[model samples]
Target: MAKDNSRDTGKNTIPKKKGRQSAVCANPLYPCAMTGAASALAGISDMGVIIHGSSGCYYYADMAVPDTLHSTFIVQDEVIFGSAERLTEIVESVSKLYNKIAVINTCVPSVMGEDIKEILADYDTICVDAPGFIGYFDEGWRLAVRELADSIPINNSNSNTNTNTDAPLTDLSKDSKGNIRVNIDGVCSMDPFHKGSLIEATRLLNLCGLKTAAVFCHDTYESITHPSPYSVSVNPDYNCADVMNRRLNAGARNSTDSLLGPDNVLRTFEELSDRLTDTEDAEIDIDISKIESECEETDEILTKEGDRYLRRHDPPRVAVYSTYAYTEFACDMIANYMDGEIVHAAARNNPPDSDLNGGENPYNIGGICSLHRIKEILSKKDFNLIIGSSFEHAAFPDSAFVGLTFPIRHRKMLYDRPVAGIQGALYLMDEISETLENGNKKSN
Candidate 1:
């Protein structure tokens, strides 16, 4: 058994004010818990995820998740009587196709309380009770990760000892060539930048002489069950490293870092490089100089580009709305690189930590959720640019818009564009500059 160093933080419980009956009931910007659970589980290529609920639940989850999904499609009769038989039939069929089956219980079936575990006792299936009323997308995602963590087989063969007392523990999984592999967490299939961010993070890891071991919910069941001890995240909100470490006893040290912004990317990689080299038994040589050089070059390019944009037009006073991590990153980029002012920054979900801005929130208002609240804020604020999803664009169609969040219906994103590593910083800045310039021209 792995070491259990986890304390009861009550971090998983849903907040009272942010529940289903909250102000976000009307025109909720983010998806519900069911969709979030499906998105996380469906990302596993080998696992067959079944939404054990009505057609509406199944369709909504299927639409949001890019990967293949299954459903029991419980009808009116099943609701009144019981969904156990219907669920069993689907699980039986799906069991043949996949190595493992995961059933996500939606609102109706969850309320039925028919003992899903007992019904699927004969088959190899994992049941996750993530109803729509539980919480928002992030809540559902975390619940699924917690459930998955239970299935991960603990490996006692790997030693958790650190030779260098000053250095952080580096008991990470390695690849065929003996390179330390790092797991990339927070890559959900529903997010538009998922593909691009995954590629960018992998590229940066390779540049620093590290291999990508497992993508949190995106990789295979085998890979996900056996994750690397060391991890880095593209988005901090959907991160599962802490949960994994807490659940698993062996090599369960917190070695995850965030790579959301330019500064975070540089800092995270630098720290990772230092930890690897500090290990006395670490034979694989890592060179972080190349990463530093590339980041510096990218920073110089961003400064020049930002300066060029500022010469033609006034800095864009923007309203940013996304997940907390993304919202912060957008606000930072606009303010730091473009010298723009953030009029308002709204997070779709709650902040991961207590500190909303680390005492540097440039925006007048922060931490507001729901489309109703956002609309109210937009009515008062005067801003040239809006950074969010289609909901924001629809509400304020006249504003200069950049689709950074989900439900991006205005434009078709055929290419896998990133928003994470050095390339990600460049791509994001490029988009912001072009959008600002175009919006300025239209206004003029």
Candidate 2:
């Protein structure tokens, strides 16, 4: 990136527009490309991220990401004289501390145009060009992961010996052909429900006689040599594992659909069953039975207890503030559990409206969605039981809320709780049920 020795105007700048619809709502609560890169890099246990920008820029990005980020405070003097020497000094100093390092270029340093590759040529580091203004979080993280894939030679040399030797890819390739070797791709440990999602996918696969080879971002170590040809991505947006799946040999399923909602999650496992076994009818039957049982258990609890609560007090209007995929997923589950209608749903990031319509309205409202926009919609259409992150929870203190996304800091999560699969759907039913019952008790 070129180094510019001038006043930076775009660091926290949000271009003003005519209305809420017209307003440039590029940066929401979600991370920019730089933050996504930094946060994603931090998931590599002892990996360190060096933010190549001003302290102010670093601070804002650092807030959402839990990892401790490294930064050489670029002052006015360094910006004027060029901070090449200073940046190298910090990189050298910080390199000894981490097993790996990612130098992330934010808006300021990117505009300044520092040739980082030449500077860090000698060090064991990966320089990522993730200008904050260029893209959103999804794009940023993909670039970082892509860079990680390109630079980090994942050969047997530095392979984590500690990695589970239960289902070695070499042995599976030779013996089983493709019976059990499965890798869960896309869902990184950076996500709030990532750990839980990993556990659920592995658990479901194991139940169906499938042995998970590895989870790309969550797994111990990923080698340059593709471990397993067969792979599944948890998020449709995430493509790190998908890219590797293309080069895989025969007898591999390279589908990259998300397991965000229960329906898709069920389909993901079914797809795996088919790939692993030629005659998977028995396995599919057993899997379907388990899912049916789980759904039944949720229904019994809600029907017996939930109906009583609604009888005493009117069902509250439901509103979900989440991503498009997650919103659809949660809305489906909520509709199944509650009699009350889903009045409103606001997406943090929207996939084009043309695609969403599909000749039918999914009722997704987006575009520079601020607190005011949310309130503006809510005033016209009253809602109850807000389902989203802590931000929405704080905004609607009067309404019953559930932690569905990020900033779930206050809630004490005992186990790795999921919000995706059968268990996740049941968990939501339980949470909503409890909230309803409690509200009834208070009212009585």
> Which consecutive 10 residues in model 1 have the weakest lDDT in total?
4-13
Candidate 1 lDDT by residue in tens digits, 367-406: 4445665676579888988889989888888877888889
What is the alpha-carbon lDDT of model 1 when measured against the actual structure? Answer: 0.77
Q: Which stretches of candidate 1 lie over 4 Å from their true place?
A: 1-27, 155-172, 250-252, 356-366, 440-444
TM-score of each: 0.89, 0.76
Q: How many pairs collide in each candidate, listed in order?
A: 3, 8
**Residue 224 displacement in candidate 1 (angstroms):** 1.0
lDDT for every model? 0.77, 0.60
TM-score of model 2 relative to the true fold? Answer: 0.76
What range of 10 consecutive residues in model 2 has the weakest lDDT sum?
Answer: 4-13
lDDT of 2 by residue, 242-344 (tens): 5543333222334555566555666666665555444323232224456445545655765665566667767667887765556666676666546667887
